[model samples]
Target: MDHPHLPGPAARHAPPEHPEGTAHAATLASFDRGLRREARPDGPGCRVERTGRVVRQTGPRHAWNGILWSGLDATNADAVIADQIRHYDALGLDFEWKAYGHDGPADLPARLLAAGFTAEDEETLMVAEAATLPRRIDLPAGVRLVPVTDAAGVRLVTEVHERAFGTDSAHIGRQLFDRLASAPDDVAAVLAMAGDEPVSAARLELYPGTDFAGLWGGGTVASWRGRGLYRALVAYRAGIAASRGHRYVQVDAADTSRPILLRLGFTPLTTTTPYVHAPATVR
Candidate 1:
């Protein structure tokens, strides 16, 4: 497959420069290489593999299974997609093929839909310079952000996620607990509290070989919306990322958080949608 658009190894290793778009592309390339090179079958039972130009990722059975860092041309797209579906089907694992706007072949999305993959919500790949992100955000007088350090803190984060998203967050809580035990410095979770009650929470995952650190699960309880709590959580995580030598912070922004992320200096580089393939048993 032609990888004309994919960055070469040298480009992936070079230091990123500023202006959000430049940083965004550099960080995306760096992260793609990092995922293929450094991601291991660690805590989340997640493992990555390289097949031809496609990078496949499989995680815990209950969690998401997916593909990443794909660079395919018209000649090979069909075979690559078919192989992925067959491999996952044999393993009885439902998987997602993550398609980014800048990905090659231009018609990969249409092909995926024809092959029985269901498109999920489209999200913006938002990126910002870590140093440019707001460092100090004022929370409501009584509310404060706290770093998660124990099971109680994990539970607090889970509670805020559940309440904010209206769904069970046990899976995320479990992953957070395991990550803390194995690579505490690589990941950090924070919770916003109004005295004893948790109001908002988020997690940051720092990639050692890349310039980007990812922000995930920044959800605030509905009652706490519009109070700057979400932005404060973002500021706190960006500070952490900067302290750890990460040059940029990236988030997969949905409707609720996209505007807030934009206001905080994040620029949308591309849209990504997950094309899911589930076996009949799963469907």
Candidate 2:
């Protein structure tokens, strides 16, 4: 779980210490400790590894593989980065290093670029108390929410995803299908169905033993936008998180979704950018 906005697990690792009173810094710190530093595998066949000052997750090629958390500065940053490159390169896996704006040395992103990693879009790490978010899920006319269970339901979810995002969803389809089959309790996948057609979709990932739940892959087909479908999806998942004793629900939100989430009482915590290195691109 590197990039929060992606359809994947939220990054885990204790966040670096921040100065007090820096606009929700304490909550950000808690998020870092619970999600980043203490990251766990999203599903079966995935493993998290802690090597020295870094924590990384490895899985099958279809699954996410990345460095979730790291402790690096000027002295060890370059060496550690090289080590990770070699490690993943040997395995022939393309991986991501999720760097936060608050991460140390203030030049981690630059170092990553120097190491041949390409930077992706930045996203705001947002969190809200599950109790404080809206709980009533009011869908658009002719739309009803359905819980996704079997492969057929997953197909519907992916259909909406592909229409909304305009990208191939096979990778996400595999991840969601496997997660539903193996650890259904850890996740809640929902689709807004209009008759036999899906108009919107989203999922909630519950982190056991932690107070946070992650909301991922919320999207509505173009025809369904601006009709409260997105808001209903958020409320539905936040309510589920609250029922499960999770105090907070977090989202790695993009510019398009940030204002909507902010209107729903979410607080901006920090920003994260993913640096991806393809094994074939460089050694």
Candidate 3:
């Protein structure tokens, strides 16, 4: 069995190369490739395209959250990006944006600061080799980890998720569980329990499309922290991934959990930030 982290069938539509770890030019080239899938609406000033759901800032001068790039058109360059920002602002999505240092024109980040955007904490892009990944961890405390497959179990995961992330995302849980239920036997969920109560929980996503399977939503209760539950869950997930023929595991991690991932043989390669924009204004 391959490790869960390996790229597999889950990625049939993905490009041959992910624009990560490449030098400036190569990286842009990689993004250019993905452009075929997600990029469009090229022009001066910013416009919301993709059925008006995505905000596209052209001419290379906009502040967007976490990795949104602006075109570096020499004419009206900075203003164009700023127009994109203001346009999004008009849409009421003026909270904050994150951009990777290596994306867009070389000076994009600096320009974003000049436009009132702030640089917050930076986290690592971690990837793990699942084949070498370890499993066989003992449950910490009284926590009993179980593989969830039923509707009730899925609801348990959703409950734990809402408490942990401060969002009413039951729809996401439903989607995950539905996929898991319909998902071939290779993909699975492992929920951690404590005395019949669902506290710490996580899920494993095995992509038959790529050599990579992702481990996501490892949430533990406050009291459960410092115990080995999270690590054990990760190990458990990794073992399942390994058994499913995956080799690489990737996660976009937050600051609080960076060190733990580092200790577990995950390597930080690059950072990706999510840029959020609302409807209206730019439309």
TM-score of each: 0.86, 0.91, 0.62
Residues 1-283 of candidate 3 have per-residue lDDT tens digits of 0012211211111112334445434433443333312543222233334322223433323322222344453444467556666665655554344444344455555555555554544444466888776676878668788888788888998888777667785755755655665554645777788888887788776655456676777787666677887789889988888877776776657767767888988766455443333334543
When summed lDDT is taken over every stretch of 10 residues in candidate 2, the lowest stretch is: 1-10
* Alpha carbon lDDT at 104, candidate 1: 71
Model 2, position 155, has a per-residue lDDT of: 91
What TM-score does candidate 2 reach? 0.91
Task: Score residue 191 of candidate 2 by CA lDDT.
Answer: 93
Off by over 4 Å in 1: 1-28, 35-44
How far out, in Å, is residue 213 in model 2?
Answer: 0.2
Clashing pairs in 2: 12-35, 12-36, 12-37, 13-35, 13-36, 13-37, 14-32, 14-33, 14-37, 15-32
Off by more than 4 A, model 2? 1-23, 281-283
CA error at residue 116 for candidate 1, angstroms: 1.9
Report model 1's TM-score to 2 decimal places.
0.86
Q: Global lDDT of each model?
A: 0.79, 0.85, 0.58
In terms of lDDT, the best-performing candidate is: 2
| Backbone clash pairs in model 3 (N, Cα, C under 3 Å; residues 3+ apart or in different chains), count | 37
Across 1-283, the per-residue lDDT of candidate 1 in tens digits comes to 0001222121211222336566566667766666543454435577777776788888776665778768899999988889898889878999999887777777788888778888766677778889989899799999887899899999999999888878888978988898898789889999888999999999998877777888988888889888998888889999999999998888888766877888889877666677789975677
